[model samples]
Target: MVRKPLPDYYAALEIREEADEVTIKKAYRRLVLQWHPDRNPADRETAEEKIRLLNIAYETVTNPIKRETYDLQRAASSRKSKAKPRSAPRVEVPKEFMMTPLGYPECFVRSLGRRVVVHSRSDDPESNFQSFFASTKLALWWLPEVNNMCRIRKLGSKARGDKRGAAAGRAGGLNMAFDPQKAKTAGAEGSEVRMAPANKGQKADSVNFVTKASPTCEGALRFESASQRGQYLAFFPPSHLRVVPFLEEAEDRVLDFLFVDFASMFKFITLEEVLQPIFSAEEAGVWIELAKLQDDEAVKSHFKEVMGKDVWDVEDFQAYFEGHWATFEYNAEEKKARMRPKQERLAKQLRATPKAEEVVAAVAKTDESELQRLPVGALARALTALAKASSTDGEAGEATSAQIQLLAALRAVGKGEEEKCDIPAFELLHSAEKVLDLGGDNPDDTVLVQRSAAARILANKALKSASAIEGGMVEAGFTLPDVVRFLLLPGAAGRDLLLATSCVKLFEGRSIPEQREVLRTAKSRGSTNTAAAAGTALLKSLGGGGPGDHVAAPDAHVEMVAEVAECGVRLPAATALLRRMAATANPLKLAEALLALASRVGPGQAEDMTHIAESLASKGAFGNFPIKTILETVLASSKDDTLAALVVPAVPGHVYFALLVL
Candidate 1:
């Protein structure tokens, strides 16, 4: 009948004895997750066993009634061994009754007394008893009651005469023991007292036994008080008792039986059973799900109803489940303390931004670590500073394209329009400037040139902000003068005129005097070459080319041609427009204008477009422009078709030959 001592429930779960239900539940969940066969593939068998033990421990010990009973048995067995040093006499006993801790009760003396000497740990705790077992014969049984202890008396006729005197003498002179149940109930606040009467009452059997404990008695040599209430049941509690017993015996023939009705037996348990929640099993699943929620309110509301206030509030339970609050708080505080200096440094930088240019330089160099060190405020301040620098440079030392783009990016962040196209003006100009500079690495890179062209619009749009911040002046980095100057550079004359023309907006608010000076400087630097080129550009620009491609130049600028032509009172805008036609207007349209003008002007009333053609011809600038185109335009508008025959004979051979060759 010897079996292993009951499993150490506390040790199985690997938690302290003081652990509360919350802690127990948490520990169980953590272990299950860690050791589930799905997660612990390498040591699945071990994990399974461990989980099994955990389930058994959690289910058995977490239940108050079961755990209480277990503790009493353990303590009782400890006292029995300690109190009785002497060996028992050899005598066989039925094994259905519980075994002593050592072996088969050491050695049982079956004759004489039927009582067992109960040795208890500490002050022997007792209780009004209950016995649930019944043998093949209704066994002679005695149970303690509220007021008096029970004693066994012989039932056979020969021993009946020895009843009262011998029984009183053999009572062992023991004091009535304290009821462990009452002591427990008195100490346990709000605990419901559970008292169920014993299954069979022996007062009805008064006719059965009347003798004192004697040497010939079959049970034991002495009778002792029942130490615990529930432990009185020889096999199982009255509620759990079943008449059916699964009978078995070993080679030694110790009578053995199992009370199959007890659901709390360790052998009846499975992993699923222990893993199951004791109370609110459904609520347990909800608790786990709530932990996954990000919204505090939802989680809080759920916890409010699911776990009543008597147990925990939302925050406490959340903290408990999340792990120790003290540790988390300490970590958070340490993190804050560690970051304080850096945060202060950044705050100071944002407040003043004295060295913002350093951050700009770092960004330009693509120093990622340094950039990362720049907080959002610091980054913004530095970017603004760099933007100021770019605008401050204007035409002086233009910021590189990279710096400008970075500034634009910062501005986008500031505007909360990173996903949109709220570009900064200075950035666009700088971008174009960088593209132009890229000519060194990429000789004649056209796509970059086009990109540079497109960037010009963003640069222009970026200007209002830049200009307002920089005192509302033109801080355009790439100037029309620069484009003009670029053309004036040696071997650059007439080159990239489309490129030069692209920068027209750079002259937006220039004074007439500035315009005059620009043209004057061009003439000085390029002689007649620059003036003629300027004149040609001016002519082409005056409503002759694609007007959409050109930004409007200053009104003062359109007058430069009239000033250069010295046309007093000058041609009307229409005439001037036609004159620009020589550079880009349709040949027929120019001829039509020529014929119209010839008919209206008598050579100098306002120096109209009367001689623009012959003037540009003197400079030999009609490499792409044909003089005959004008002639043909004039002749075609004439109603007199015979005038061409008269004019043909008067034209020079080379001029005539040039017309035919064209």
Candidate 2:
């Protein structure tokens, strides 16, 4: 039985649940300074409890799994204790929005949930805002936007609940001041917020827009529908161009004529850096007039004379603008500027992986798709932690949507790049049946689940996934269909029979040719040489020393023996497999392996065969074997003279088989 719950650590820590990790750490360190046993002599008992609770909370929330579980339980208990109605979903904050010459736009949710996009100038009298809203009973719920933080409030008026105010956070510490004594109108989902007239003392003192803020900075823009969509009238932020005195629409047309709408990617950079001495306030007025002229001849001459540059094409102007502005993707589905992964990238990445810190940082940036470069365990941990950090323990929230979207992104990056997970699990499989806790359940049923869970957390080559090791299906991302054809396979040695039989059944619906390709990759290449030897021993152990032991599924063993002969055979582990295979002494295996290697060699292809022969000779791979059995087997397969010459390539005037099969 589970133990009773411990005391809540957050209460002891004396911080909000949403406190940042660094903030939490800072708080913890502060407590240690104030209440550590060495420091607290007057009230040691209380300090002891406080310290104990603080440590427990820090450990619990910092860990992803524990946090997730704790969040779930805590949320449930909180909901049960408090009687509160669920809040309605709201539109996401903008990633980056370029303020039109008129001003920054405010998005509002209409009664029926439609969006009304509109902008207002601080200096534009109340009449302009009233005319814009015109007969719509809507309220402007102003929020102070900080550097990329999107914390939406529920059931609380900012003026009363939040003491700090910037009306709307502005450059140079200037902002609108909110009057809490004024009217408040808010509602639940499907409810409308009635509009009220702009009251006095609510507007900015004056409008001066020559600002140092980046014109466009990013925020959490949602690609999906927005509740805060609205219509916009000609408006502009009061900037250096405020003195230009041109009609808003006339100038916005020329500036944003070639604009693209790259969502969520644009970032703001200050214009002061680009326009310092190049374009003074007086010069900006002249440029505006040139844009409004509509006469090509007059506009061209004036523009060139003012900016000190001759106009080339749209590209040239776009380049110039880019130097002074932020970039965005177009609304039309045009070619993207971002780079995609190269096709040959996987060839090198098969063995390479990112460091742990890099993986975690990718998660923090919410660019979780790059996690494909990380190990499975690390990927799981980072993703889980990111999901946990953004969300509370209970019902799905905005953070949950973000988490699911991140998963979709990560899935895309993992496509076609996976299945190189070369994890070995032959020994583990042999023992899986014993270690699995079936809870009085069937071992066969539980084995697949146990193996999959292990594989998901397990890292390393030859140890990726159990299914990957057995069936070479490592490329199959995140999908596991474990079907057992037999508890023990027909012809395979040891537990490899389990995999072989199960593999055949795994893709039961596939064609025979397809199945064979799948089976070969899974069993032969996925498994280690140690597993190969165990498979070899199974036939003899079953008292079948001949081909009839397991019916010939295919005449070729796919040459597990040739595998031992080639490149990997020189390793110490490779030497051991060779010795064990010799001791097992299965002639059918020998014949098939010999033919497979022979198949590779021709008169000109003697180098590989010679190397194999030397490795076998060095290992004393063949001892007291009947030469006639091999000779007859080789001769039977070697019908052509050229083919026969492959076994013993002639050198100068002599033919010697490298002392291997002499």
Candidate 3:
């Protein structure tokens, strides 16, 4: 059952339903002042009752949640009344246009046995109401374009009775249309509106343009079909709808439609609704020229104030409104000039702090190379300052500048030969590992470049010691996939050694089954680096490398063999699979086994392995193997020394062998 309706608060306040927050507050204050009990001492009881109702109304409407709940309850009551049968017989009234709750212009049309009428304006009642005929109402959707062009559609019979017009939204209705050509005749009127088939749904034919009424017709407006020249939509002497040619003399008696503003029709209005048409015109590049024709200073100043607040508050508002003088008169260069002092103040504040002073002074003087000479802890402190500032949700351009400076300092400190790991630089890497790990997958391109550079520097230093790798994983909270992504960087110095060393340290002290689970967990993360790294680590664990390679724990070699055994091979048969793979004469047999291994894995795992193999093979690192057939054929078939070919000078590579094992 529907609940009882909320009290008529808006009627009590004597304000329109679309009154804004400022207006609502103003109305409440005015009512309270006029009906205060002290001001009406002779009738204190009545005055106090009036003041009490006014306070209740004001409280309900001002609180947003209360107002929303009140509106819902009121709407429910209205719908319930609409659903009930009327006790009295129907009364025939004149056909007229009325505004729906959603602010569409609709005219009622009588048809068949049904009789309906829109509530006509009481101030200007129709003189010949008995002669009106019945038909469907047409709802007009005003489009954003030149001269207020709109689309008119026939509202379904069910929708016509709904005050909200919820059933007659923008889509799926019979529409009216007109030709594309503008009115060429020298007269006040335009073309006729034609009834368009519902199935056609073509936008071009349905557009109609409206014009402000001439002085003779006072507050009314006229709609003219775009293609039908010298005609206007009008009502005849007895209120019958028809398309008629324009005549200069007729005023209130004919040839004009009253235009009702949305504030009077819609129960609630938002700023978004008001801004949509204006922004549409702005985006279409005509708002500037249109505003020039009007000479309203109050309007221009109000708009400037609104847009200035947006420019100061929104992240990218400056880029959007830069140099648009007509709309908001915003200037990007001037805004930057205004912000220069604030940026200088921030820089001065940073320089006053002893921990950040030296780096800030160095950066201000454009001496980034001098930053490398600072102590490791000091350098890390400086980097942390800049990185934290850069990652803030501040203005986009400021963050970008901070990120650029951070990268420059990083490059200066990290610049050295790969063979000689500088003591200060390695210590800097240790100190800044947290900062590097904090860099996530930000959408900004500069952030990604900085992250890749930091990762490369860490990968270079971490390759020298397994303990550093373990520290990064266990203490710094770096996952195996994180290390894998760092190792796969384009500028990383010793990726192969780092990948193998990191994997061994990560999977150490765990069982063969636990190690397999770890590898599965890494591949399941859905990162290209994790899958490729897992495959490469697995191949290295198995005895896929040459004789000079370091031997792992005995059980590590059996993990992939177990993976293969699960794919329809018996355990005893799988134990000799790798041995037979090395001696197989038919490369197709090796290719089939690789395909079967890939088929049992997750999506994109095999593809990632193929890409890594192809990229390395293109650099001439993998000898005597056809580039196209490298992944298909076993790398074990190659010459013994070639299987351990290096990706870089210090890093022995095994990814190609891993691709074959898959």
Candidate 4:
């Protein structure tokens, strides 16, 4: 007996296998709306079939038990199919359709009546049918045809050669009559235009026009009737669109027109599949705003915006897709390089001015690119100058001010790539102020303090003798107690735990006695923060609970927990530190944090991690994160089936997601 093949509920619903309940419902609802019979009356039969399959898929997937059973069956079926002998299918391969550069080109052929709507080609505005007509803003499809030609089908039409004349043509199709001889004459003399009468027994009256660029207007197209001599389709008076005589000077004349692309495809694809960039949905949809395409200047601007080129064509679009649209990415490094001169100017001003705060304020006001370009060496000198100046007065306020500037400059510099700084660790630590003075009055100062502390940790790691940097820090008056305080601070904000954990990690570089001091401080404290507790746990886990016991570096799990906590998702149990990741963090940062946490998960922790991930996800812990980013994060991180159960919706209707998953 043969086992029945399991149906693909996920495919029918148009979602990923790991899609959570929320994603399933959303996909179901969207597909229902799109394929509802009432909404798609023109294709009611197809809509009905779609709605039926969608209901089955939705019902199966939305139920936990049914979905589980189905998933199992699907997995078994997949394995069985793979194990079976490979056999070529009997069905013939479909012909491949090359997506036109003009993007679906599915638009209505609206006629511009003789009232001079846009411009006056003739000296007299009234005579120039080429220039003006009011747009009805009505939409229609410009279906593709063979030999660089297309059929201009009206909204309700199916047949092309309707012989029932104008009324039938309006109801079904239009027949274009073109006289080749007369067309040549009209082209040469720019005088008269005429077409031969329709031949007998032509059932469909549909007119086909050769697609060509308009000679009169840039980016606009002029459609001269294929079967008629010099006759072109134009909007008649009273808003009726029909073919008439083309005259260089007359009441009725040929004119250029615009095309508006619509989502017209010969085959069906899920909304999610369409949205994925890897699918190159460009072929599936037509070009953007037809009005822009019709204007010479607008075309240039459009290409520049999308492809980073002042001008582009069909070939360029093809190449762009083939290269995965890399040109579209904004290169901040290049942009920052462009602002190098501005950064140098600011650094010069910083060196010249004794009021470092004013320069720091100027740095704050400067564009991120300019700040990124600011020379690290120059910044170090300015910081060293501030520290030296503050030391002379022995004023706490002046010292605090220098530290404040240090924090601001470090934060700004931190925004760019770390490798760009290029300064040696010793020089940076020696030249830049080592102490993080606690003297600010603002409530926001705590956050700045935490971030600056974290930044300091990162900076110290750059030292040549990173392990013994504690000695240098002590000499600079930032003692072991100060490091302990940073590590034991409440993990209330995104960077608080990060600062704390980073501080604990620094003990690795300290002497054994110094490490003992950190452990003793934690034990001595009445209330211990998460980081201190983690250190205690680490000491106990490694069988060293005694005072003389040596503390080891933080375990991978501890560091992972700290990192996730730093992303504002507190762990052991995933709870958010902030109201939303979107409020403070961007998508890239959030994705990185989640993936980093995931990558550290051992096999034994997969189930717990999945639950934590799911709970965090259900609570919107990730914020208004992009689906593509999350999908990429998930795909790159893990292959654990249990973890895969943590559903995150990707770019809806993107084929790229499907392609990548497959």
Sort by TM-score, best first: what order?
3, 1, 2, 4
Residues 578-649, candidate 3: write the lDDT tens digits. 333323223333333433443343443434334323333345433444444454333432422222322323
Indicate the worst ten consecutive residues by lDDT in candidate 2.
253-262
Q: Cα lDDT for residue 509, model 2?
A: 39
lDDT of 1: 0.35
Q: Per-residue CA lDDT of candidate 2, range 135-197, in tens? A: 122212332332222221111123323343223332212211212212121211111112111
Per-residue lDDT of 439 in model 3: 39
Model 2 misplaced stretches (Cα beyond 4 Å): 1-382, 385-403, 411-559, 564-587, 604-638, 642-662
lDDT of 1 by residue, 179-286 (tens): 344433443121111211122242221111111121222222222223432211112111111111112221212121111112222322221222222212443222
For each candidate, the alpha-carbon lDDT, in order, equals 0.35, 0.31, 0.41, 0.40
Residue 480 shift from truth in candidate 2, angstroms: 22
- What does candidate 4's lDDT look like per residue over 1-662, in tens digits? 12123457788888998997557666766776677555774665476567656765765565443354355434533431112111121211112111111111111223232121222121122322212212212222233343334443322223335555333333333233333454445553232212222323332223455444443323335455545545555433222234555543333332435432322121112211222332232443223332233244534443344223344333332222222211122122222111113344466445332244444355445665665455665555455544444333345454555456545555566555444334444445544333332343331364356445533533433332232445443333344445555334332233333334434444444454454455445434322453453443333333333333122323332343334344322243322211122133333453444565565545655655555445445545333556655565456535656445445554345535564766
Q: Which ten residues in a row are the worst by lDDT in model 3?
A: 84-93
Question: Which RMSD values do the candidates have, in order?
Answer: 31.2, 24.6, 24.1, 32.3
Question: In model 1, what is the error at residue 382, expressed in angstroms?
Answer: 6.3
Candidate 4: worst-modelled 10 consecutive residues by lDDT: 98-107
Model 1 CA lDDT for position 51: 61
